[model samples]
Target: METRKKILITIGDPAGIGPEVALKAFLQFHDKAIVFVGDADVLSEAAALLKLNLAIRAVDSVSEAIFDKGILNIIDVGALRGLSWQKCVPTAIGGRASAQFIRCAVEIILNGGAEALVTAPISKEALMLGGVYYLGHTEMLAELSGATDYAMMLTGGRLRVILATIHTAIRNVPDMITLGRILGVIRHANTAAYMLGIIAPRIAVAGLNPHAGEAGMFGREEIEEIAPAIEAAALEGISVTGPHPPDTIFHKAYNGEVDIVVCMYHDQGLIPLKMIAFDRGVNMTIGLPFIRTSPDHGTAYDIAWQGRASATSMAEAIKMASTLRLPTWR
Candidate 1:
């Protein structure tokens, strides 16, 4: 029998749409070995709000989880105990509980209980309110795993983008887009391609400036910083190309001309990706010790408990975490 890979999922902020989407995903993917790590009450309330006809089973350990359909198995990290059902807001208590859920998921992966992690969206503001200071899921996971060379890759609708600089001020992006950073992101993109079953990945690098610095007319970051990085990567035997214009690089990725595109900043990559496939996008954290994927969207607080959140992205993230092969890790 082929042993199913055990995957852990953390329902991000209790007050956000994480719980709802997660439950919906479980309903669709009931046969997979999935362990939910979060507050049981929050999940139960979410289930009630969504009118989902399923049982939320709170297991003491991962081994006790029931992968059978109609049962949503959770490992209860104990958060948001007494809050009103479907009325929970972004409070410090909710934030703390969200952080605990992620921590618990990490512990499970390290303890050989799970092979991968698929986290739902967590609120940065809520995390700060709870006194847990980390930029986002990628940074938090990197710190927890002591990984120094990590990259964030977003995949959806025939497009895969790896961000060179993540969660930083726009004004500071030019300075942060160094040769080392671009090189690292290119390498990560190549690794991601390999995991996606692309043996020799054709990488497309997006320029930092308009028209690729207009051949040094608009900006020199591409001429001075990005070009050298591409040269270095090519010399290292990695198939890479461009400093292509930011506006059109994504079109190439969409048309399947390249396996992945190395982007300069967060919005530069995400705008095209979200525009292409907002609902089914999967946020993958590369260079980690274990596989970690999440929904490309954040905690949608407005339509959280109204049963309006879509589970497409969450389901795709879970599927990627379970199926993607990481040959680099071997």
Candidate 2:
């Protein structure tokens, strides 16, 4: 029999519901071997709170892990000292632990000890309070892995969105939607589709302005920047389409008219995809040397430790990671 792939699962912020969802996903997908990279004590407490029957074994590395039933192999990062989970307030120890867990997980992936990484939701504010100066997992991972260009792709069952600019203010999106950036996003989306086993993926480009700038009446970005980018992609033999209006492009893509939609801004893509499949959408980082995915949601501090967290997105993330192979890193 073939051996199961080893995936590194990081339980983000102990003060949040990372541990709970991690356990829940593991229980649902018991056949795959997962090495939980976080504090064992926190996972233990979460398992108890959820009334799950499982065992936690501390392993030094992923190779030493034994794929067994009902046992969760973990690389213990140690528990948060003097951290209270009664409320979702951020503490120094919790923030430090979250950053440490991310660092350790990246190291494990770099060393070939893990095949893929599935990260739980993490709090950006908590990480900053904990003295880390990175934007989020996608940026930190890109810097750590030395990836030059990358885009955030959110995936549900049917609707898929690749963002040209993420984590930028809406007001700044107009200026940011340059021809070079649009071309970069198209190339990344093409690469991502190939990774998912699509030979010639159909890509639709969304406009920065309403109604695709109404033929330069509302804005000139569609004519000057977006249309040229799409033309350049087409010349490369890619199946590219549109400077379509944001309103109809996502609907057409969701209905199977296109394989992927390249949105010019953050909410332009996310609002539709999340509305369609928020509970199970997976956030995939494209143009990276390695395969990295995370849940579509954030650290639900308000419902932390209340057993109200959902594991659907985490499960989908893990499944996507396992299905796709990473590009070779030079």
How many clashing pairs per prediction, in order?
Answer: 0, 0
Tens digit of lDDT per residue, candidate 2, span 154-257?
99879989999998788898889898999999988888887788766899999888899999999999999999999999998888998999888877887888
Q: In candidate 2, which residue pairs clash?
A: none
Q: Tell me how far the alpha carbon of residue 25 in candidate 1 is from the true structure, in angstroms, after superposition.
A: 1.0
Global local distance difference test of model 2: 0.85
Candidate 2: lDDT of 300?
A: 88
Among these predicted structures, which one has the highest lDDT?
1
